[model samples]
Target: MSQLPKASLKLFPCTIGGEINYSIPEGVKMEILECRNFIVENERTARRFLKALDRNFPLEETQMSLLNKHSREQEIPLMLKALEQGNDVGILSESGCPAVGDPGALVVAMAHKKGYQVKPFTGPSSFLLALMASGLNGQQFAFHGYLPVQENEKIKSLKYLENESKAKNQTQLFMETPYRNIKFLAFILKTLNPSTFLCVASNLSCEDEYVRTMTVQDWRKTELPDIHKKPTVFLLQS
Candidate 1:
């Protein structure tokens, strides 16, 4: 009997919100050069990221596939076809680590089910960075991707999260679209209790990185930082 060949699925983490060359590790760059097939959230950014990782990268010879919110469930398995062919496949998100708060999770799950080796590389993660700087209860925390968009629904959800945090002493973390960050912060400040502590981490790992923790009352008193149209993470603890 002939032995079957094996290939690994590599999960590469890009910069959370900083210069790729400054943030990406040399090991990750070397591993990226080893794989020619990649499943990315955005092909354009992934290409740019690869190019930034190494100017000598052979982009023309690489195979790039999209796996984002618009990706269908049926199309995911096909994305892993490269792995079955004894070729290592890489996964990259628009920013930060793939699969965490990103759609790459779907393919990662499928990769595991197919018995392929799934390897994750270390890199910047906005939520984790925020949590570390939050001065909140790191031991007890939960990440709720996003809240409802509707005003009433969002307010209800905020109140619920605040109550849950107070009861469990867990830090609650979430995010919003860059463009809506200002509005979201305003809403959070207005909705959460005055005594509740809120931490806003913006432009993480970047030149303009900002991370501040304060009570809702203190935040109200101080002038808001210019987080408009910037990637940010919001954390609350009561």
Candidate 2:
């Protein structure tokens, strides 16, 4: 009699800041060969990543389902069908680790509830990378994900986070859309206390990676980096 396959949900992390030349472990490549079903943020980018990992990856045979901010809650369960059939299912985010700040968390949570084993691969996380180099209190840090887009609300949120950091001596981390990087930096400089420390990590792990920590007052005097339309993480501590 043939042995039954052991089903598992694998979470694979990709390179951050859109740099694809970064190295992927041989073990991860070997594991990718075992999974024929993938839940990804973008089918095209996932296919490209797999192809980049291995030029001869079996793209035609593999199946990919979309899972992003717009994906419906009802459609998530369907993505796990392959696991029920005793096949390993993989989750891929557009960049960095899946389910960290991505929509893949929903499926991972469901997998756990349904009693499927979840295997996460080691990879770079932009936020953690920023914190490590930010020269701030790493022991106590919180990731706020993103700040408000509106001017008044955004300023209000910044003040609140700065106050919280001061009260707890904790590091507060946040990010903004690539296109709004410059404007957001300006807001941070203008709103936060001059004595507060701020760190801006941009295009992490890429060839043009930039990570700098400085006081809000110092930041005002120094020339700004060309972070426009580039991925960046901001850290502030008062």
Candidate 3:
């Protein structure tokens, strides 16, 4: 489902990905989708997977699925039912804020469809945090959500952004799946103009958080961090 900006509303999307690798509390049953590793009781592997995904590129979407059909549609009803039954169904993601930049468009779409009033609770966001700390012109930043996925087109897309970030001086922020964070960082180091500055914000809102900044050339000279190992966000400024 498409998410709007966060406010003080209890109704919101959760990046269950954020709670991945942790034990699922008893009596806190959820309709666990068969997307990640089966870890109904604990999801260590799923947690790490998503963490790495966050480290590289901002995920373009967070679609929940079941056999043949999607589950986010069902999720809205389930959450409503949960609230009725004195329980709250957490629309959790593998990591990070749900529906912020991840895949929760269908669920959010369904909630609004059924006339549910939504109020978002404040939580961590990769895009906003990166822009705030990048030391760039943040007043007019434009988050492109996620970069293009196709290989050739993705590079071209980034190149185009190079011009946009330079000409307009808007800080550009995005991410990929956690496992690809390192590779993506490598590409950013290799491609973006030398004078521009890049920031890699990793494991944001976590104990292991790391943010690295460097020019294109300096990035090439120094070894990059293993961002693929955890939640990471990439930011660029001219």
Q: Give the candidate number with the greatest TM-score.
A: 1
User: In candidate 1, which residue ranges exceed 4 Å CA deviation?
Assistant: 1-5
Residue 149 Cα positional deviation in candidate 3, in Å, after optimal superposition:
4.1
Candidate models: Cα lDDT each: 0.91, 0.89, 0.56
Candidate 3 residue lDDT tens string, 22-102: 323222222232122121111343344434434532223332222112343454454344333333233444333455554
What lDDT tens digits, residue by residue, belong to model 2 across residues 1-238?
Answer: 5666888999988878555445356687678766789999999889888888778888999989999999988898899999878899999999888999888889998998889999999777899889998899999999999898899999999999999999998999999999999988998899999999999999888889999999999999999999999889999999
After TM-score superposition, what is the CA distance of residue 238 in candidate 2 from its true location, in Å? 0.8
- lDDT for position 193 in model 3: 83
List the candidate 2 regions with Cα displacement exceeding 4 Å: 1-3, 18-23
Model 1 scores a C-alpha lDDT of: 0.91
Clash-forming residue pairs, model 1: none
Evaluation by TM-score, superior candidate among 1 and 2: 1
Tens-place lDDT per residue, model 1, 1-238, is 5656778999998887688676788888789877899999999999888887878899999999999898998998889998877889999999989999989999988988988999999888999999999999999999999888888989898999999999999999998888999889988888889999999999989999999999999999999999999989999999
